[model samples]
Target: MTDKVLALVTGASRGIGRAVAERLARTGHKVIGTATSESGAAAIREALQAIDPANDGIVLNIADAAQTAEALKAFLDQHGTPEVVVNNAGITRDNLFLRMSDEEWEAVINTNLSGVFRVCKAMVKPMLKQKSGAIVNVSSIIGTTGNAGQANYAAAKAGLEGFTRSLAQEVASRNITVNCVAPGFIKTDMTDVLPEAQKEAILATVPCKRLGQAEEIAAAVAFLASSDAKYITGQTIHVNGGMNMG
Candidate 1:
């Protein structure tokens, strides 16, 4: 077996996912980043060129069970199971609970919650066989704070945390750890689209008086996947710039 650790990061076209993929690669892993579209996958591949020429991206819409299975199987057949897997692919459909359409709720839940389910299901067997792996899921503060106009997102993220805990218990005996990283407001394309006034209002609420960086979140994920975190699982590390603290 190759001594080089391998990591797979979903939704790596941009934002926090991209940062995680690059960070893992820089930390000595051969990273395979996924994007929903061919163009996005290409962009990921190009972005990682500076770190490792062998680093590449794949087109994977985690919402599609067949595609997720096929892609994962092909990777396993070729490169074996990754030592680290980050479930970072998620979407948000904002609307009041009263006005939330069935399509909107389903879309967010299916992609954010069920997609991770599919990925985990596919990875579990290999991880069990390998007897060592880390699965770090990206959750959100909205799940805990309960943001308005984001019922679907909150529900999905909360469900993800629950899922993380249960899976951690089931696989801990095999030395596989499952954990979550819940980020507060981060400056991604999703947050960048907010109006200036709205952005300022949010910053005002954060004790740090600024939005979190993608790299900061990536750092949290890297730690959780490292040996330092081998004894820690079934928990969440909130990286929200003191937006919401215990």
Candidate 2:
């Protein structure tokens, strides 16, 4: 792949997305990392620049369909369609299924599941014409194991896997592979906010004896998005450090 090939990483302001953008940039791809706020966009830009001093950053809210389309179209118009797209923009509206509000459920689905669809739909045209591309959706261990308070999040992530598998088959002939990475207990901003006791309890279950880093998850995404994984598609690679073996 050329160093100029553009890669778009959603939720790139921090955590796993930021690490993934840095990794891809280090590999020579001109990465575009998206954030939701002005501060977030600034942060992403600064973070990416810290890695390569020339990578791009933009603001995007995946849950908003119109903005998602417009932002992607703008990016493609200015830089070119990203050959690699990472669907890492996700949110959690954690609550028991019984008490979860409809809005909470909708917001989670819109951002995590439908957001991936919106992005894939916008980018597939150029990828199909080019006849080469890769998409890696970020899933979660909760999606597979069903965490009690993360009904909305788990459902959305689980749906992303189904979408990846089906879309992989649809686009494989075009040389565009779709896959997913299910990360567990990553020490991200989200998990950092977890209660100390909860964090400790969760850490005990991880055989690695510690939480995985965002960089660890980024490594998996980089490998899967590279030509090294050309023959791999429609697969979900777990990066939970032996938390849930499948």
**Clashes in each model (backbone N, CA, C under 3 Å)?**
0, 0
lDDT score of residue 191 within candidate 2: 84
Show model 2 residue runs off by greater than 4 Å.
Answer: 1-3
Number of the top candidate by TM-score? 1
Say what the RMSD of model 1 is. Answer: 1.0
Q: What is the lDDT of residue 64 in candidate 1?
A: 92
Residue-pair clashes, model 1 = 0
lDDT of 2 by residue, 1-246 (tens): 345768999999899999999899888688989998889988889878877766878999989999999998998898777789998988888889899999999999999999999999999999999899999999999889988989899899889999999999999999999999999988877787999999999989999999999999999999989999999999999999999997
lDDT at 231, model 2:
99
Off by over 4 Å in 1: none
Q: For candidate 1, write residues 1-246 as lDDT tens digits.
A: 446798989999999999999999899888989999999999999988778887889999998989999998887787788899999999888999999999999999999999999999988999999999999999999888999999999999999999999999999999999999999999998888999999999999999999999999999999998988999999999999998898
TM-score of 2: 0.96
User: Which 10 residues in a row give candidate 1 its minimum summed lDDT?
Assistant: 1-10
